[model samples]
Target: MIFELQNDYIELFKLIKVLDLVDSGGDAKKLVVEGLVKRNGEIELKKRAKIVSGDVIEIAEVRIEVKG
Candidate 1:
């Protein structure tokens, strides 16, 4: 999947919610809190980690590529 970036960066949880990966923003944060998300192939624990264009996020079987 691909996510077009509209700004310099996007928060991790916000991206999850924007993509409808979870039912709610809280759910999206929980997904990250539990170490269920990966950024650039490594476990990402920060829900507000800055996600910039060209970044790759992975959750479960979903892979989202950030494109400018």
Candidate 2:
């Protein structure tokens, strides 16, 4: 699943909120804590980690590619 990234850049938590991937900031943190999300194949544990253009976010069986 591809999600469009705004401004080709986004702060981590803001992106999570904007994507609707999680219900809220708390949920976002949960997902990260559970190791349900990956950034470039590494476990992303920080819900506030910045996500920039060209970053690949893998969640479960879905892939959200970041583009400018």
lDDT of 2 at 22: 78
* Cα lDDT of model 1 by residue, 1-68, tens digit: 99999999999999999999889999999999999999999999999999999899999999999999
Best-fitting candidate, scored by TM-score: 1
TM-score for each predicted model, relative to the true structure: 0.98, 0.77
Query: What value of lDDT does candidate 1 attain over all alpha carbons?
Result: 0.98
Error in Å for residue 30 of model 2: 0.9
Model 2 whole-model lDDT (C-alpha atoms):
0.77
Off by over 4 Å in 1: none
TM-score quality measure for candidate 2 = 0.77
Q: What is the lDDT for 14 in model 1?
A: 100
The worst-scoring run of ten residues by lDDT in candidate 2 lies at 8-17
- In model 1, state the lDDT of residue 62: 100
RMSD of each: 0.4, 1.8
Whole-model lDDT per candidate: 0.98, 0.77
